[model samples]
Target: MRWKHIVAASLVLASLSGCSWVNKLVYRIDINQGNYIDQTAVEELKFGMTKEQVKFLLGPPMLVESGYPNTWYFVQYLKPGHDAPEQKELILSFDNSGQLVGMKGDYQPGSGFFEAVR
Candidate 1:
């Protein structure tokens, strides 16, 4: 009679193990969102490059909510596990004539970002 009870409990446990929510408890899903910018491409930026040139190098901006079309924003957000979420925002400012003038972002650009790196 005890063996029968053990067998019955085993069936119930096996059925519960197949539940999707149970799997969620054991495994955590990784979250990846937004565009990935290349550091090498950013190094290619020049002071007088046009918007078209910047776009060709870095792809389109994720958001341009500064109400200025000349200002382009590239953002990449990643949250993994219980740690702090990773955030990267790249800002490109274009002059009135549509030429790129400045850039600010999470990248350091290194000492020779604009120049050749040895």
Candidate 2:
């Protein structure tokens, strides 16, 4: 009888642990829905623009590549729980020489620009 109780208690504990794991998975923030830039802005980037100029034009980039001074990155993401899917990305090669090199864009699940939020 004591062994039966122990087994039942163990099963309860196991189920509770499984539930916690499932909750964590379900509530996880999808880091993808945060994109605020669009393709028109990307297309407007010119090779001779300075960093300050770029900031003025497109606001700040989501990331700036370290050790690569000339590299600037702009990224937008949408997470799954939200109205859209999350985005993960990298932009390469912006230099102080007033030259833009190797600018790139990446999107997942679909390919297109996310309309600016406002």
Best by lDDT: 1
TM-score of every model?
A: 0.65, 0.50
> Backbone clashes per model, in order?
0, 16
Model 2 ranges off by over 4 Å: 1-35, 80-84, 88-92, 107-118
Candidate 2 lDDT over residue span 1-118, tens digit each: 9999999999999987777566556655555443477656665655555677667756777766577667767667666553456565647455557555455657221122222121
Q: Best-fitting candidate, measured by TM-score? A: 1
List per-prediction Cα lDDT, in the order shown: 0.78, 0.60
Worst 10 residues of 1 by lDDT: 109-118
**Residue range 1-118, candidate 1, lDDT tens digits:** 9999999999999897776666557755567778788888877787777888778988888987667988888988888754579889889888789977677879655344455321
What lDDT is obtained when candidate 1 is compared to the true structure? 0.78
Error of 2 at 71 (Å): 1.0
Cα error, candidate 2, residue 27 (Å): 13
- The worst-scoring run of ten residues by lDDT in candidate 2 lies at 109-118
